[model samples]
Target: MYEQISHSLLNEILDELQPNAYERRRDLQHFYTRLGANFYAIHNLFERLYGQRDDFELQMQRLVETLVRKYMHRPRELKDLDIAREKDHNWFLSQKWVGMALYSAGFAGNLRNMAAKTPYFQELGINLVHIMPILKCPVGKSDGGYAVSNFREIDERIGTLEDLQTIADEFGKRDILLVLDVVVNHTSDEHEWAQKAIAGDKKYQDYYYIFDNREIPDMYEQSMPEIFPESSPGNFTWNETMQKWVMTVFHNYQWDLNYSNPAVFIEMIDVILFWINQGADIIRLDAVAFLWKKIGTTCQNEREAHLLLQLMKDCCQVVAPGALFIAEAIVAPVEIIKYFGEDAIIAKECEIAYNATFMALLWDAIATQNCKLLTQGLKSLPGKLERATWLNYVRCHDDIGLGYDDNDIRAAGYDPFAHRQFLIDFYTGSYPGSFASGVPFMRNDKTGDARISGSLASLAGLEKAAQSGNEQEIRIAIDKILLLHNLIMAFGGIPLLYYGDEIGTFNDYSYRDDHDKLGDSRWIHRPTIDWQRVELRKRQGTIEYTLFAALKKMIAIRKETTAFADFNNRHLIDTNNEHLFAFMRFDHNRSSKSVLVVSNFSAEPQTLDLQTLAHEGFGTSGQLIDLYSGQQPVIEEGRLPIQPFHFYWLSEY
Candidate 1:
């Protein structure tokens, strides 16, 4: 990795480092080792980005100094963790790891309060917790705390930095992983840098994509798609204060950082390392797909963006190698795979990514009462690289967009356009006989595109079944909910359970009353955690108890089954039956001990011919037991019978 120019620059920077007599020399040595290891790639990326600048070496020196200072500021315990993780690099890929994503207030009252709720997570068998964005932001203009005014400080409404540290320390004691969000894509207008830019500070103005007029902005807009057409409308906003146009792809308050500037990249890297030093086990890089902008393109998933991530990761490896990065890019399946980097074997960029296409395909199966599309879509998805895993979840704090490709739709025996319209109609309750009660979000009149927003319980028909007091329908609804959970649990990845999904919490219409959250329907699913409803989880045979107990049992079983670990040991079994989807999970250590998972998407009983899966270890006359329910599946002749909306985890006994 040593190059002449880059190596000479590193030596010069090290010599300029005036190490005091008090442990400063040790700090310098640590920085020197890390810089020497990563400088080759860093220098190449930096030079590629800003080689034309007159002061490239000065900027390179600034970048090195930033890393050294952050490394010095990192606490001893986190540094120790970095070393421990380097020894055991694959710790996160274990099947034993289960994650839960929750808001600070929704899970507990604040950061400090979350410490006392550790037992609550334990009860649900969750060890990885993603505490959604809690950084300080301007009131009401926070964009769910993503529009950060300060990166180092926690919001007063949540808790202080000390509280966050305490919570992280407590989690470590119990062997839990704490994930936090770093809004790397943008900053709030109220942020000091943004404010300085608005105040006509020429140096700070370069931090963002600020232009004197629409001449340049309009050119970029031609290829950029509007993210929030209903509310934000366009990709650029005119700042009256500076009399200039600013790139605001998300919201007017959230200004996109100009990553084309090396200084901006350096500043963001410092912020990322700051959070890792704060004890974040995993840093979720928000909105990474739109980092690098260019003319004549969609300004997404650009090649330079990947290089920036690779450089950031390389620098982080020097300081906090234990802390992993999760790419928060929800783009097409092809683009999503690139976030893991194009490396043939190892992932050079993010270690984890969201499996958004699988999520949308599951919903498609539900709406159509057929697994045709799900199977086709999953088969078309490109295989991910080694050393990288997916964050699989049924729901999060955001709406669900139908991102299925048209070719896959046609292959599944459906018109692409009509099927998408059907899914939207079914979820929004506009289609006849649809059980879902979701509301539409960001409906675009130009493209007729929309997303669904509602709680898992509501979308699964629990709310409707309970409201009508239909006992049979309620049982079916509960079964559907459990079926989805079972899939995510047995699936080859970290199963991220959204808060309130365990006890079948319904949607809260109250978000319509809060002016700050009223515009976004995603708040419907992000309801406050009702302890009273959670209490119902203890009452035997109750709806809440049914879901909580079932999910807890499934989680325990998943942890024990090493076959479920993410080592790319999954093989799909085509069941010919359009209503049934099947896959096999092979244990790398004990190859003979594998599990065959099959689920029926139909309301009526469905059957899968056991002989068809013989190649994948399932034979016509073998003794197979359902691990989730601990019962024998009904096998008549050579076909296994699956109950209405039922799923099975079958293991040979």
Candidate 2:
């Protein structure tokens, strides 16, 4: 927009921006300038959303007013950091980030205790810690802390605000980033807004999608898939007090926030900035795919949802510039990439997104013990934006939904539905001769679509090994865990380890005894980290010692290596061994060396023809070095051999 024209609009909003209401200083001026730059996009969106209302301009005026007020309220230190970050725009794309996702209490008991574990993180080369939501929620009914009751308030059971501040400060001193969840799509029904809504407050009731009857909700449910079928079946829940039905996507307690309402968007935006200002470097926007809903649509990855995110990103840039966003949208591979946004190249959307496709591909490799599906899936994955990257992980607090592409499955010569059904059965031990001991989380009766939930160790075959007490099986299980970890570490993105996976923490069936938790199977994997088990990491022979030491080494290696970057430099290699998954990460400049990562998923020994690698430019001259084994390859004519369930991180000959 023309500077004069923007100035005219600014003149119009000057009363609301309240130039005198602020200190009328350089900071306020700079904020006003940013608002002017973003005003066009924000105005267009806000108006398109609420322009029909008589108070559309009033809401835009208020939103801009809120941004300026928040900027002025922002701490000076954070402001300085934001200024510095604006100067170094791509600062977040650095290779130094290594992440771990864990519950606040499960990891250390409280926020203060989590802060105390800063040294532990530093030791493990972790620079980003995604502490699962520590906000207030109903004790047992909470969806593992996701059913947020308040945005700004910390859960009293976790710790005080002071503890969070201390932890953020501690992490800052060491250059570690703190990542927190902002459950933007929903809030606990007991939240103040929900309570007001229950009391028949028309304004607050509009905060959620409330229908007088089930007619509309049932129509929406015709297309919307059930996230937790066995636990929170169906999308609508009856509210006796209001005598209406409300849409609850995940759980009955988690009332989906009405994004169609501009008020709700503004409030959530405030909540987002609230935490970013409070020292959350990266805010994980939880369940973002379900943010926008339309009656006839599946209500996943709606266009307005993307626009809302784009607006959120623009607004945040005007306020908390240093903060980053990780979109927690686990949709189809194609749909998942859009969370980064088409306008992402201009810093107009999320900085990072969960590489759910790659995650699902890795699991496919685990199940099929072949790279065909993984390779096919990788080929189909849309390239991520240059500025945005992926948060790669094998498991999180949520269940594993096989969100693979049907075309890829068909290309691999398997019936897509049957293959997925097979995976569900294999993981849940319903299929004969399956090694995995997982549970079916949300089994949708209508479509037979079920998500598997279990700890990494249990799902990876360690639990069964421990019961057998077979030395060979236990060793293989440990190798499989480390093997997956190695891929994530070297796969050119921020690798996030689910809290207890480092020490092979198996699923705990104890949650079945708790009334609130028994229904949610994902809780089986959210085990409390045992400090004693952690201590045994020093004792070489124990399971904890072996798994922890191996994982710690992988983390150290990843931190030291510069080749692991998330740019589009990866190439899938055909090793001709079904059990071995091989890929290469190349330097973008093409001058630097590339790393050949070969992961053997099977227990039996697997070999790849060194000749096959020669065609891919691995045989430039001398012997290739296996980073994990630390052994120089016996490349006679450049053919390197590998062991069973083993991997080699090879550089150029």
Candidate 3:
């Protein structure tokens, strides 16, 4: 790490530091040590990114100053927490942590009320809370708070920054982790920088991709696929005030930041550290794949983007080493793995990533009533870095895109295009005998592409069954709900539950009335929680009570299972039964502590041959216990019968 070039440059930069900064460094011994330890790698990455610029040294000096300022502003309690996390680096990779993602306003009224609902999370056994975006943005063009008009200020519609601090304080006392979002990809056109650009500030104009005419935009549009093809249609939106075109990959109001400029990179880094100082344990970088763009390429998953992420990570390490990052890149499996960094042993970029492929595959099994594609797709999922893990979930505040690979679809004995279309139709209730009540989102007319949007309960037939008043159908619907929860709970990662899924909350049709939300069908699943309906969770025989009790039991069991800790210890078993999906999770240190998870996706009873898992320590003579049920599985004649839409967490007793 102490290469001559990097060390010499570091020494030069240290000598050139201002008098106040030099004195501050002397007082902050730990900061000085961390900066020294990380400076070589930081310099190397920064040099790789901006080495050719004339103001390279100036930018390097600015980056270090930003780190020092943020470190100084970090609270004393957080500093102690950081040191503790540093001592226990792999603390997050534990079975004890369960996460729930919710909007502050939807879950409770605001940040203050959300803080008071700590008991609600505790009652459900959740210790990690991902409060979706609460930043200031334009009223109608917020894109669900993804478009930020002010990076440092909290939205007035929500509570103030002080209210957020209160939640952090209260959650810290209850030993809960707070995950916040940093929309790193773009900002609202109403942002200060964008306004300056509109005001003819040439320097600010350089911050975004502003064009004089359609020539450059036309060239870029050839390779850049439309994100919102139906609504936004194209990648470039013409600005009347500036008489120029700006690149708007998501929506016209969200202007993509030009990462080709080092200043822009430095500014975003400062913004990330700003949130870390605001008591965010983990920062989810939104739309990370589109960070760096090129004219001729797809402008996604570019090499420069990865380098920029690496640089941001190195800087974060220097200031807040304990704080973690979650990459929100929902791309292909191969490309998504790189967000964990290409390191062999350690995750240098992001410590966590959304297991989107697993999510999509789970839905595939639900629609097809088989695990063929789910098995094949997972087999194709690349192994993650040893230190990195996944954030497994059944649903979130977004639409589900069936981004399965064509080869995996073909291997599962289905046509790629036709299979995707079937999923769209089946979930939208357009296919025959389909019980799902999902709506279509972002349907591209030119390409015939679309995504599905609905709550887990609605998509699993609970809504339709309840409406039909069929007892048998309702029971099967609840079974399907628990079956999906069982898989994510035992899967090798921190299982994330959506806000109202625990009580089987249905899709809200009210979004159709709000003009801003009418166009986005994903809002159907982002329903406001009805406390009155939530009270039904305590009333016996109600659907809410049944779901809440089952999910709570599963979460408790998941925490107690030591093998559920994520260390890349899951093995996908070939059940050879199309209607059945099976996998084994084992503790890397103690292989004897293993659990075999088996689920039946069909409506008919299916038998699993015990001999198939004989090598997994389930022999004919031993007793096999289902951890969730706390009873011995009924295995007769070397076969275990699983009831329809049921699952078991079996272990040798």
In order of appearance, the predictions have TM-scores of 0.97, 0.96, 0.98
Give the alpha carbon lDDT tens digit for every residue of 1-653 in model 3.
56787778777876776757547444377777788887888898888888999999898888887887898888888888888888999899999999999999998988889988999899999999999999998988999999999999999999899999999999999999999999998999999999999999998888899999999999999999988888888898999999999999999999999988888999999999999999999999999999998999999999989988988898898788889999999999999999999889788899999999999999999999999999999999999998999999989999999999999999999999999999999999999999999999999877778999999999999999999999899999999989988988898988999999999999999999999999999999998999999999999999999999999989999999989999889998878899999999988779556789999999899999989887766554567899999999888898999999999998876
Candidate 1 deviant stretches above 4 angstroms: 21-34, 620-622
Q: Largest lDDT belongs to which candidate?
A: 3
Name model 2 segments beyond 4 Å from true: 1-7, 344-347, 589-591
lDDT of 2 at 464: 97
Clashes of each: 0, 2, 0
Tell me the deviation in Å of residue 320 in model 3.
0.8
lDDT per residue, candidate 2, 1-653, as tens digits? Answer: 44564456656887544456786566666676677777777777776777799887678777877787678788888888888888988777656778899998899998989888998888667889999989999887778888888888999999989999999899889988899999999999989999999999999999999999878988998899777777778899999999999999988888999988889999999889888888888999998888899988889999999989999998998898788999998888889888888864653668888887887788778877777888888888887887788888999898888988899999988999999999999999988888898999878878888888999999988999999998888988887788788888888778988888878899989989988788778889999888988888789799998987787778877665667866667888877766778888887756667888988776566677777876777756765776766778665444565666778788864
**Most TM-score-accurate candidate:** 3
What lDDT is reached at residue 360 by model 2?
Answer: 76
What lDDT is obtained when candidate 1 is compared to the true structure?
A: 0.89
RMSD of each: 1.6, 2.0, 1.3
> Which clashing pairs does model 3 show?
none
- Best-to-worst ranking by TM-score: 3, 1, 2
Better of 1 and 2 by TM-score: 1
